[model samples]
Target: MDGVDLGIEPGCIFGLLGPNGAGKTTTLEMIEGLRRPDSGSITYGDHDLVRSPAVARERFGVQLQTSAFFELLRVDETIDLFASFYRHTLSTETLIERFELGEKRKAYVQNLSGGQRQRLAVAVALVNDPEVVFLDEPTAGLDPQARRNVWDSVRQLRAEGRTVVLTTHYMDEAEALCDQLAVMDHGRVLDEGQPQELIERRQPGAFIEVAAEVPITGDLRLPGLERVTHEGPKTVLMTQRLDETLGALAEWAKQEGVPLTGLATRTATLEDVFLQLTGRSLRD
Candidate 1:
């Protein structure tokens, strides 16, 4: 990543958001001292990462995208193994209970569910009792309920006064968790701010959504219309003047004999901000 500069605040959940191949993982790895950047400085307060990566390693806990543990090791044993590497560590029992892994404490690593494994990974990361935690796609693949469970854990981390640097492509995750956000695309930082601030600054207008079957074959001729695009089975019309756009849309629908099925209007979100900056959807 080039021209990337970010300052993560203490005791807040900071998110590095982008799609796959957008360099989110690379950025997180660099900060975690897993990969060194060719040039640029990484510092936590007075500690310089380039000159002293050990300091970062000692102070920051890491949960990689894929955490591999011995398949035969029990959950408690796995936590004990990771805790052995740190000078200062939390109690394994507390860690297991915090992550909601007490029921699977005796289960082998290979037998746990995907959500359980992910929780165990985060628990292992916290074994060091580090001040800052780096989580790379902490909730990548899981059911909705599992994803929400991880979210709760992350919030608890912030509540405990630990700085969390998380990378995720899920817009809802960013919106729900991040106190500060750095939107990245390709290999550069696009924008940085709080979730709502970035959305209002980057995509300040409202969006009008209609069904794709309405057959909009050409550019829409609505006042204050910024752009029109297709998202799955919906046609989205972004506009600065919501009243004028809605009036024009109603007239146009009546004139064209098109049914405005599933019509809705709402404020722009972080997903809209990402698309506005990169010209690509967050899921793409």
Candidate 2:
């Protein structure tokens, strides 16, 4: 990580968003005190975490991108094992109930489904009842329903007054769940703000999507159009004056004998802002 900086507010869900190898995990490890930076300071309130690693370990709970526990261990036993490591802890039964793993309490870790395992991982992370929680790509491999389940858990943590910090490559997830976000690429922070604020700052206008049998080349000039980009089969026109641009597009299509098979207009989104800033898709 190079010169990546962030300020996470208490009792809020803060996110670090980037694609693979963008230093999101590395940054998290440093802050978690699992890894030390060569030159930099990591602070938590008045304590310097870099120098006092024990302080960070004591006050923060982390669920890594991948967690490995003994497959033979039962769900409740797993939570109990982790709890024993911490001086302060929440009860295993309480964690199981809160994370909706009550039925699987006696089941082995290997016997749980993907979603159940994820919930179990989070339950173990909270064994210490730390003030701050860090989840690294918590829902990376889960199904839609399971992803939403984990999102609800993260929200619950905030509602309970614990600061939540997480990393994600999913733009929609970050936009929906984060109170504040830092967009990162190539091991550096490109931008940071509230999701909507970042969108408005980087992509101020709206987009009109046009679908045509033929390619909508840039040569087709339209009034009030800022730029044109092709995404898959759709040609996206970015513009500030929506009405003027729409009128001009219709007129141009009519004159060119082109049919507007599918046309839609909508406000800018975090995806648009990411494309504008990085000149590539977030998934890339």
Q: Using lDDT, give the best candidate's number.
A: 2
Lowest-sum lDDT 10-residue window in model 2? 215-224
RMSD (CA, angstroms), candidate 2: 1.2
Q: Which candidate number has the best TM-score? A: 2
Please give, for residues 1-284, the per-residue lDDT of candidate 2 as tens digits: 78988888899999999889999999999999999999989899999999998998988999999987899999999999888899999999899999999999999999999999999989988999999999999999999999999999999999999999999999999999999999999999999999999998998899999999887875867788998888899999999999999999999999998887999999998888888788998866
lDDT of 1 at 206: 96
Distance (Å) between predicted and true CA of 29, model 2? 0.5
Residue pair clashes in candidate 1: none
Error of 2 at 226 (Å): 0.7
Q: List the residue pairs that clash in candidate 2.
A: none
* Backbone clashes, candidate 2: 0
Q: What tens-digit string does per-residue lDDT give for candidate 1 at 1-284?
A: 78898988999999999988889999988888888889999998998898788888877899999988999999999999989888999999999998889999999999999999999999999999999999999999889999998999899999999999999999999999999999998889999999999988988899998884555768579999998887787888999999999999999888888877788999999888887799878776
